[model samples]
Target: MVAPPPIIVLAFFCGTSIARSASPGPARPAKPAPIAADARHKQLTFRNRPRVVRSGRMRRMNMSTSQPGTEIGYTWPIRVYYEDTDAGGIVFYANYLKFFERARTEWLRACGVDQHRLAEENDAIFIVRSTAVDYRAPARLDDIVKIISRIERLGRASVDFVQEAWREGTLLATGSVRIGCVDRATLRPAAIPPSVLAALRHGPGTSESAD
Candidate 1:
């Protein structure tokens, strides 16, 4: 073969080297955009959201002999509505107090103690004196939770109760509440009426711990 001209060969070599140098190296991946702090917090909240079970799959918690020395009284089943939950669809911690209140009210009604009548006839109304609650698991929206209320201590002017919120076999929250009788007009502490106290003592499914 005939040799190429030196100048042409030199020019071709230079052009090839220039082209190789100008060409891009392996493409680098694009950098992802930074996530907003609030958005990252929301993502983590969603990722760590409590496990929710469908209503159809829910099973009642057994009130077996596991709880010894404690008598289980009335149970009020409450359906969790949208208003009761927070943004994450979990029941708000404060709402459990409302659940306990409802269960206690129902227990009173079952025991033939009507608050309205008691207040009108006896000039006395029950008021919550104090509450102590501990949260365990969480109840989700659309869940049917059972509030179990039992009388822990019964006194002349006040009563103490132990309440629990349960979903299936899972315990969601527990509370201890003390309710005191107060005069309707003065709001001062008053004694629970003899008839009302008697009803509470002998009411169906009612069992008070000895003082």
Candidate 2:
């Protein structure tokens, strides 16, 4: 073949370089690594553990106590796990707060209240304003504890609760929690919706307790 002029070859090379430069390459995002099988199994196990369980075995029993006018309003059962214990092996004092919180949440659910719906539909949410807990004894791992809760006082925007932790008729702890209603967006105090207030007053202690 006859050789082209050096200027012609140079022009062709320059045009190819310009074309390559102007047409950008496609971008490929890096893919996330897949989770390991063991990790996947652990995650599934955690998800399978339910937040609450109400069974037919949980029957309402009118409890008589030493305290004046003390009556059980709601009861929730909890099993102490190793994670709930402290270095000394007994249930951690602070973990009682978690127990009390769970009991109150379940109590409200029994009262026909859904906290998520309250926040989304009514713009209202419940917040713990104050809490006082007294420890009488220690709870150990694998022990099934019952949290007995009752309304000590009810107000337009807040509620006072009396909660106790018991195991086989032994009192482990007692807590007084005050919950206040607030506007979810503004975080300012707000009145409890009338329907919710009515439910709180009438829903619990009116029917057989879920076993």
Best by TM-score: 1
- Per-candidate TM-score against the hidden true structure: 0.65, 0.64
- The residue-by-residue lDDT of candidate 2 on 46-130, one tens digit each, is 9999797555853223333324234456878999999999999999999999999999989899998999999989999999987
- Model 2 Cα RMSD, 1 decimal: 17.6
How much is 127 displaced in model 1, in angstroms? Answer: 0.2
Stretches of candidate 1 exceeding 4 Å from the true structure: 1-71
Question: Model 1, range 100-203, lDDT digits (tens) per residue?
Answer: 99888888999988899998899999999878788989998899998888766778998777788888777788887888999999999999999988887776
Model 2: CA > 4 A from native: 1-71, 205-211
